[model samples]
Target: MFTEEPSYDVLKTENAFLRARVQELERALEACVPRESAEEQHHVPYRKIFDALPVSLGVYRRDGLSVAMNTTSLELIGGIGDEIIGKFNILEDPSSISAGFVENFQRAAALGKNVTMPPCAYETAGSTLATIDERTVWTETTYVPIKGDAGIEFLVECNIDVTERQKTQKALEEKHALLQALIDNAPMSIFANNLEDRTILVNQRCADAMRLPPEAILGKTPRDLLPEDRAEEYLREDRQVLEKGSGIEWESERVRDGKPYHILMTKFPLRETNGKVYGVCGISMDITQRRRAEADNRRLQEEIIRMQEESLRALSTPLIPIAEGVVVMPLIGSVNGTRAQQVMEALLEGVSRHRASIAILDVTGVTFVDRQVADALIRAAQAVSLLGSNVVLTGVRPEMARTLVEIGADLHGIVVHSTLQSAIQYALMY
Candidate 1:
């Protein structure tokens, strides 16, 4: 019992030694364990940030298994822990949200960079549940990578429903195609030009008529297709139309390939919404056939005139004697210059032919007489008298007498009577 009395000092010494050894080991272990630096401590809060994001946020390991996800991500995937943990594959379907998505994630991890493909098509069981019809579900997806203390991590994806927008765009494209078809097939030659007088658009008819492709004529002015002189005229007219902001109709002759064409052109000043004239629009009609017809008609008219004059001259020639008796030429219809000349010629010829003692000019069938008729009658009488025959005129109306007297026609050598009966009686006396 007396020997154990020295135990307090020994116990104290042993306790001190144990304390020192424990302190040295704690320092060694502390140096080997590698404590988190300030940067790592700062990034500790990033996990909360990723989990609290509104968009579907996810952190995937390089092995294609989802390591973590936010609430929205979990909701989008239908579940978080066992649902999409490691069972999901990436290459089965390019359109599958869980399928090709892993491939994109792996690519980002490999490059240690961010990659974005144009909104890719994606499908998933979770998205399928949201779809009304099982046939189709359209979504646009995006993938991102996050770099932190855990090294580069892949984001699963966030999908946005774009079915309506895609459908609208497709419908618009279809409508545009249909409208272009109508414009191309239109009957009339529709066209448009820019302010610089360059052709911007032309339909098939216009291109065909110009003997050029629609593309070939683009950016070309009328001057390029028209002759220099004609181009100048067209430019002047177009300028006037633009200045006046009005419409004009013009007829012009165009020669193409050594052939002439008559064109009826109507031009209108093209205007903007503000009513400012920018250029001119025109429509042309080929009137070559009409012009040819008119020319032919003119030629025929001249020919008819020439023929009538020749006939009048032939009738005006004096006739030779056929018998020793009177020759009768009964005047018919309204006698004008030509007809009257014929009658005079026939009368003189008859007088010469018969060597008749008397010549009677009958006008019973004549409707009305003019100064020309009276002149022709006087000429006939004078001619007959010169031939040594007594000339008598018959069937003279009062109006005819007045007209002849007013015209001062020399009818003194001619014997005039109101009826053919009187002339015949007078001739018998001769």
Candidate 2:
């Protein structure tokens, strides 16, 4: 009670001074804490990160010491986690690394930068295995300086497994190669075209058939390679397929390198992934030989018909009639210009051979007689009349007579008989 109540002004000054000093210390502490350290700062715990990683991960020191390793990393290295943490030198161990790997790591450490490498096979426990950790094995290995209370403590190493991705990439490459081979060696001329008939893909056979390299035909339409009139026919067919969304097969005649080709073309509508018709796919086969054979067969068929007609006409011509010094010729079947000529020749020869006084021409079975037949008949009668033989034409249908008159057939010196018997009786009576 006697000592404590004396100095109130001093106590107030001391208390204010203490509060100001505390504020100053707090500001100093804030100033002393660095926002970002120039030295490498490991904000995330490396040990915790390594242990938590699903894939194998390891840390290598500058001296090639295995400073830290996860469970998967230790198992892949053929050692327990505790055993490999301080003992394994990934650079010096040939069983775990490829040639020049140590040199590459040393170079990266010296340059204080990242260096990437190609994949290499490593031997582990007398068996060759592919290293899946690209960061530690094949890809870029970064060496960053880690500063701690102990100076330049460790070199942070990361392992990234890229095995599954690499395998998929390799499989894709092989598929691409196989597809290229199939396109190159295809038998027919396979081609792809746009809606405008411009070519997009052409197989080897197509290039060869066009007498050009594959590069020359790319992006070219039939119009670019052929005459405009010819190109229009091809483009028309292609447009039909695209518009109708159907397949078309046709024969195309092409001229390449001054040689003619008969190409059997088949075109189908090409659809996109969304089921929209984008273009057409076409295959063409060389059918020159087959076309030639077909033309030859047609010619032979025509020749056979001509020969058969000649045989029929020859057989149809009657032998020279001997009875009553007269010859009778009966007409049958449809008569055309060619058969008409044959009939006239056969009749004239028969008249000359018989030297008959009367020649009877019958036409009861004749189907139709045109101007050509009427002209041949008139000419034959004139020829027979010149040979001292009177020509009597029987079986004159009313329609045929009108047609003959309309066609201006001259029958001034010819005798017309309605029946064959009437002609024969007239000849015998005369």
Candidate 3:
């Protein structure tokens, strides 16, 4: 009828063209929509698992905008699904911005890789929908980038709360710092060693005394750092302390700066709370000057005592020459056996030195004479007679005469006078 109804071959060509166009449109529509693939379907179950995790997780767009968040992530940000799904921007949100989440996200997106950050404080915004209070918490966050055909598509943020752990770690660090300051600044030499004789700790003074750094001293035994003989002695002493389970104070010699030193060291066993000995601790002080002073004092005192004894001996005996060819020796104080011998020696020496023909022995100053003194006087006279001199004894008081008689001391061959004047007169005449 009208141009053969557009020919059969042309109709078939048009139909085929229409079918191909419809198929092209369907492909475009499928690409435009987020179609689920086998791989994407595998990720679906993992998404559910991630949402149930205790850690906060979120999928952020490459533009730092939140795309989807788990319940934990939503609770961490104190926001609802609608508030965060399409409207939340990490850079614009007060909580995430303060937490530095936006900067971490941008870095992961730009680098198209994972970015991890140290612990940081995350502050919550005051909102009624917030699960947590408006307080700061310590968190360690990591951002992982999701890749697509156009490069990075999204960033997955994972946050871990470490508030309690960080608090405990900070406290321990502060205490350690304080203890280290005390140990370094101590005045005395202090050290600790293990049971195997390995050095565990040493103060600054201890290291300086040993002529080594503190770090160099640790883990080294006394045998490694000290002279061989000294190390052996030190180890023995330390072992005794550990075995005794008590503290001991002893003096030992130490060499430092090319000089010898006397050290007073206090050593004790290092024990645990259960009273098991693990090692030993020691504190030492330099006592070289004090010991030297003590030795010097002893020598000085002995010298003073010797000088005083010499002075006393001189005062106890005196020799006097009263007239020509006459000599007199006077003895005073208690004449014990020792003093009697000294008197005899002095009289004989005086007679010979003066070449006296007559010798007078005086006892006038001798008070409270004993039998020993009487015997000593008689011997003096007899000895003078042997020297070819006339011996005359004087000052024979009644009490001394009684003592001489009681002791059966006979001076028959010796001349006896009542006073020193008589004895001197008689001796000069003879």
Candidate 4:
């Protein structure tokens, strides 16, 4: 298996630590086995450090005879190394050559120095190295060439297990790729800025919105990409979001493809695992069509309101020229303050336009007579009188007469007729 290079310093530190601990153990072992046989002393090297090491280790000759392995090495290989350590020869073993581990060992011996190998996974097959797992065992190994006056001597193979770390790294990489894909394919413009207000991430829509490539936008501040005024507005919003640790929504306008667009923007703070607000993220949606539709609707609504007002004005004070020097205005529905004012203006204008001696206000269609309605009638009549026109009130219902009197409406100068026919005859005669 091929993997990223392991740290060189870590391997060297492991070797140095092992050597120091081995020296201490070798002193103690030498004291215990004094006056032993040459054969017994010959086995001293492996016995000196096997019990003291926590790392998997093996001592191999340059020609590739495995001299010894520690207790940890036996445990690392799933308790199978004890049987093979003294018997296996890596340079001659078909499995070792096939696994290509022999090349690294031979390289270390030729250089007469230590070499740190990249991480590798080994199968627990009929190979010289047996590791316990239903899956391949991942490890990083460093080969140290021990030299003597006779030239290169033994090779120390140190192995560090990295199965769990490799799995964690792979999982994180997959998740990152998934997240990137999601953002890149999103419809709305999405972006994130770091603490320095530099663009850290921008999705496909964001790049397209700016009419720039992703590489052109990344790592650049808004000022670099947009006009100063617009960039400052964006920066200010970002600063506020980061400071408040909250979100804000607002509408703004921009031009794209030579056309103006209204966009609704939402900006929020991005938090780290520790709950610290590290940056701001934003998404902008183009609402150009919606804004245009709303504007059109407003214009339509205003036109409708204007048309209704004109119709009401016409109905409120309809001036009919019954004959020369006569005009009749029919007051229908309820008369409010605004309609009353219109009534007075219409009557005076009608009197002048027809050169009439009298103006008749027919209240036959009036639904109810209140103090306000009576007052409006009185005020309108008084105003028309000033224009040298007499306002003759027709359709004077008994209830309206009571209301007019109770409200103290002074109708001294104005003529009151019970019917429009009588009012018209009276106006022509006057």
The candidate that wins on lDDT is 4
lDDT by residue for model 2 over 120-222, one digit each (tens)?
4343454245344332332233345455575554565544555566667778999988876798797688988887778988888889867899999989999
Candidates 1 and 2 compared by lDDT, better number: 2
CA deviation > 4 Å runs, candidate 2: 1-18, 25-45, 74-79, 97-103, 120-159, 186-330, 334-342, 345-364, 367-378, 384-430
User: Candidate 3: lDDT over CA atoms?
Assistant: 0.83
Lowest lDDT 10-mer window, candidate 1?
315-324
Which 10 consecutive residues of model 3 have the lowest summed lDDT?
Answer: 127-136
Kindly report which residue stretches of model 1 are placed more than 4 angstroms away from their true locations once superposed: 1-90, 94-191, 196-198, 205-212, 220-238, 272-285, 297-360, 365-375, 384-392, 397-430
**CA-lDDT, candidates in order:** 0.71, 0.76, 0.83, 0.85
Whole-model lDDT, model 4: 0.85
- Would you list the rank order by lDDT, best first? 4, 3, 2, 1
TM-score of each: 0.49, 0.52, 0.52, 0.56
Error of 4 at 317 (Å): 13
Error of 2 at 353 (Å): 11
- Write one digit per residue (lDDT tens) for candidate 1, span 317-399: 43433224444445666778877777677777667667886777767667778887788778878988998887777777778
Question: In model 4, what lDDT does residue 153 have?
Answer: 84
Q: Which portions of model 4 show Cα errors greater than 4 Å?
A: 1-54, 91-100, 110-114, 121-137, 193-198, 220-250, 265-283, 296-367, 371-397, 401-430
